[model samples]
Target: MTDLNARHAIVTGGGSGIGLAIARSLAGAGADVTITGRTLSRLEEAAAGDPRLHPLAMDVTDESSVADGIAGAVAARGPMAICVANAGVAEGRNLLKTDLTFWRHIMATNLDGAFLTIRESLRSMAALDYGRVIAVSSIAGVRGLKGAPAYSASKHGVIGLIRALSEDFLGKPVTFNAICPAYVDTDIVTRNVNAIRDRAGVTDEEALQMMVSQNRHKRLIDASEVGAAALWLCDPASGSVNGQTIEIAGGQAA
Candidate 1:
């Protein structure tokens, strides 16, 4: 573990799943981290697991909320030096069935939320001239998912944002990157399995298999896999890596 002592970090949607895993990894590396989510109770519960994890209720979709929430975290901890825009929503919907509200809902939480988090974190980190911005995008962001047009589009936007930000910070200490994981073993997969069972009238086992088959290796990725990847980007050795999308899809996302 690279000693992150005295470093300040932020992980959005850190209440559970991949976000929580990343938070824990950063804390274990010695960075003071604030985990934020829409629900205060969940955030508190997650924070209780580690002294380095502090709970902050912040709705990433809302601009003011993200600004104020990050500001509050800075006030309590310190200016964020590492930011993981890991909060996102994923759902499968046909283009025909994806209404405006559904499309906006997906974009707001995934793309817009990442934008806000990174924007605010930049204000703080740029002041110090050092930082790492990691966005938890998806393989869907890199390629198209069959049934989730809206979700895919939103994730694609996240990659675009990161790429653009990296260019904006060229020759600077800050680095912007995206992690595109195909199917991480997280609560999102469980929820997706239930949805698949309900919508397609498939057996629970069949529903589970459908997602497993999405990855070329025929296995779900562990949350820790993604966490370790995020932690590595924050390592000082990764300073030269910028404007890149790292894929963790077991194999090529096809």
Candidate 2:
């Protein structure tokens, strides 16, 4: 629908969840998409015989892995026109209980991973006349989430990086933006439900309800909803919508 034919895109952490959804959306729009994750089998399975979707094994937390993986994608598909930095880990720990290791791990995956992915994609995108860079942040980035200081800080850093890069590339064809969503119904949410159940000593249903209530709409967001937002940003009409954070928090103002 967006007429992304002849375009090449890359989505990091695309084995499942939000990243996979975005990758599928881009591919459905006719872009040749490379989906990367640490698990080759999972990435391949996610590709699921789709000719438009290519799978690559990559570890975002490792600098060399990101650099090489992106390079490989470029070599295979050509210059990247759309880059989605969506690979992230979500975990909540009380500030007093968070150690340096925990903090660094969150930063490395969520913040550093985004930085490296964007930087690598920009290398080839700069030579092209048109490009779009989208980072998957969280509502927590806009406002600090309770008991997840490190995760919140990392997501906030992602938005900061996107905004700064948008400024740096003003007047250029490349546009940078961030997508912030709240309590999406994904595997992450499922895992978080279990964690909360254990930590809060609540039933799984109640724990899930906690997340659902966090969204302004009082329901879990469908992953496809976020995918649609990403697709809209990549549309030709969205060229002017640069350097903005599009919140999919069910009416929550970001």
Candidate 3:
């Protein structure tokens, strides 16, 4: 509902999935959007034909990359009033199968990446009196998933960070929040389906059904649904809604 004609927004992993939907949604709302990912080709494809979309190749896990990428974007466009830390990978391995390498990879991408993005975004955002920072966490952050200890931990860290930051900036013009969605129909779900099939020795249909069954509505959530939530969080009316996790689960799981 906010007119974002002059606002500049940054969405990581905007090449595909929920990130792409959020990018398009923000741009459609009149904001100039900068979409970043590791792949230049995909970012280009996502931005093509949309003047409001600017593509920047960024690897969020690297401090230098995030610093330079955001700097270039702010220089070319303007200060970032909205920052969405949406780049992440979802995978599950039981404690028995989980090693330091696997656990570190998840934490680096899901948790550390978000930290770097938010920190860098604040530099540009400080110039403005108001800003919004939203992290894309998961239902796992609310409750532990059956087999994804590391993924769940990473999401938990995200919500914890948002909560603490909100209080740290209380009474300021900036706000921090997170979204915890259940079973979104992103490419991540398809990959998770395949993993479930292989691990449980079940048919693809059965594997998919397992995920669907977890949703109270017994259906996969659309990516655009999450996008709409992101748009709402960045809206001017949402300034008072900081430190909250807006769960997109079909029912009250918490």
Candidate 2 displacement at residue 180 in angstroms: 0.1
- Over 4 Å off in model 3, which ranges? none
The alpha-carbon root-mean-square deviation between model 3 and the true structure, to one decimal in Å, is 0.8
Q: What is residue 233's positional error in candidate 3, in angstroms?
A: 0.9
Ranking by lDDT: 2, 3, 1
Per-model C-alpha RMSD? 0.9, 0.8, 0.8
Candidate 1 Cα lDDT to native: 0.93
> For residues 83-118, could you state the per-residue lDDT of candidate 3 as single tens digits?
999999999999999999999999999999999999
Query: lDDT of each structure?
Result: 0.93, 0.94, 0.93
Clashing pairs in 2: none
Clashes of each: 0, 0, 0
TM-score of 3: 0.98
* Candidate 2, lDDT over the whole model: 0.94
Clash list (residue pairs), candidate 1:
none
Ranking by TM-score: 2, 3, 1
Write down the TM-score of every candidate.
Answer: 0.98, 0.99, 0.98
